[model samples]
Target chain A: GAGVSQSPSNKVTEKGKDVELRCDPISGHTALYWYRQSLGQGLEFLIYFQGNSAPDKSGLPSDRFSAERTGGSVSTLTIQRTQQEDSAVYLCASSLRDSSQPQHFGDGTRLSIL
Target chain B: QQQVKQSPQSLIVQKGGIPIINCAYENTAFDYFPWYQQFPGKGPALLIAIRPDVSEKKEGRFTISFNKSAKQFSLHIMDSQPGDSATYFCAAIKGGSYIPTFGRGTSLIVHP
Candidate 1:
């Protein structure tokens, strides 16, 4: 694709349930990132993938958050036992370079945990 | 810990005015500073970026002013327009790290 793509543009899940969000980065981009945006809050780093694998997962809020990428292209973020606080926009971006270049972003999936 | 701090949570500017938003970071290791513009129900897009080596960078109506000594940076939008009304964010990334720290965005309202 010409740009990053995210699936399930909006999702409403019950509290204590689990949800999954998908992201498909640019064709040749080797670096992918996941970020969360809450109301009145800034973009919060969640995790990053470099060629189908993640090297940094420190930003995940808790053990309930997990992500995986396959074929160095498609990525999925899974949240287990969703909480109301998890309601926010989950954004995905990709860059040609690992960490030094500008990133192209997706429209993002707005998750509303009820 | 929040590495970047942004000021003026919201601003209202008349068309043709220049709206300036400021940001400061505590980390000296940051090498790149970029500003992003976001609209309601949309993701943020990169507006402009500046490196620590450069004091300023300009593109079209947007300009970035950098102060390495103070770890401060600012975005200036010249000739602000109603379409320019959106949320703006300042972000910093260390040279070797892929994760960028973002500051709480500033909402800009360019009234006609």
Candidate 2:
């Protein structure tokens, strides 16, 4: 409600199974971002959405990773045929402006591929 | 290449000690720098930020020292406490770009 919200706080799935992670951004926030964080590693940018412009998917690691922001409010990140390497904490953030503004983050969804 | 480089993957300090985390960047276009703190099982939250125009900024016990010439910046915690233990991240962002480059993060432990 007041902050960026992510669903499925923890998800454990078998390898090769598909999964979808959801993010509900703060009200009136026009920018949303997705990132992957490995154990004791830096955040790897996954995708970015600004207003109505086309999402910047350049940081996606593979074709299996895709995301979409519907109605400019909520977004979902989907991984197809997940592999063990895909196991990581998927973080979501929302900002009033773009990168120039501070982002509010949610307690990310921890996705495990077993 | 990692645009932002952070040092000391892990650190430990006694209560009331000062712990500093360093980060460096190679991008000249980066104008905004921010630090985030994340606790166990939680995402990072913006702690403090400084622009290139200012050399340093202070908020509470957290201080950010920026050196534009060296393209390096550091975060200092004054009188750190056990409650301050967490992972810290340094990020650099350029104007007109939506993507922000983040450092590998530093894990700090303030022991009581």
Candidate 3:
């Protein structure tokens, strides 16, 4: 079975540009999460989606960051007006509906804002 | 507030040695603890996990020693090898929340 996967294994863009990162969760996984790992830093929570219900966007840093999960499978994270501070590896993970289950992670998309 | 705190940013051990990574959490609600391993250019994978009800769990050469009252936990790797070199993360979850709070990762290197 295919695990979670992200698009554009690597991406580079200029400051003030917008970047959209995509994630495809494992089959039948109803829970999906997005996280950011900066250099020498821990994983920072971003947004999470469970089924068709409202997402938990509490972890989103600011209004410029947003995400949407469509049809309960694919998710896209959009960072508007990217800044050098946005340079980090964006990770996506998925798990079964239960909270106790282990999460499966994707290789992540490394975004470099120059 | 960061719920979980991990220490010893990195560790180096010789082959056949024991390597231990520790983590502490401030949240008492956390009942499930898990450890994840990540290699270069790869995603994190679950290594071992334990719930509050269990004091310890051992799977092959990996063992998780959990202390529920102290809110502290540790992962012990026996007979460490170079292949075990990677970043390790400790995570915990509270109640029914699906998202788990992760700790500052620890990079472990085993030398032969």
Highest DockQ model number: 2
What TM-score, to 2 decimals, does candidate 3 have? 0.98
In the range B1-112, model 1's lDDT, one tens digit per residue, is: 7789998899999999999999999989899888999999888899999999999999999999999998899999999999999999999999888899999999999999
Q: What would the per-residue lDDT of candidate 3 be over residues A23-100, giving only the tens digit for each residue? A: 999999999999999876788889989898999999999999999999999999999999999999999999988558
Models, CA RMSD each: 1.0, 0.7, 1.0
TM-score of chain A of each: 0.95, 0.99, 0.97
**Model 1 lDDT at residue A81:** 97
Candidate 2 lDDT at B108 equals 97
Residue range B16-111, candidate 2, lDDT tens digits:
999999999988999999999999999899999999999999999999999999999999999999999999999998877878899999999999
The TM-scores of all predictions, comma-separated, are 0.97, 0.98, 0.98
The TM-score obtained by model 1 is 0.97
Per-residue error at B57 for model 3, in Å?
Answer: 0.4
Task: Report every candidate's CA lDDT.
Answer: 0.93, 0.95, 0.92
DockQ of each: 0.83, 0.87, 0.76
**Judged by TM-score relative to the true structure, which candidate is superior, 2 or 3?**
2
- Candidate 1's docking class is high
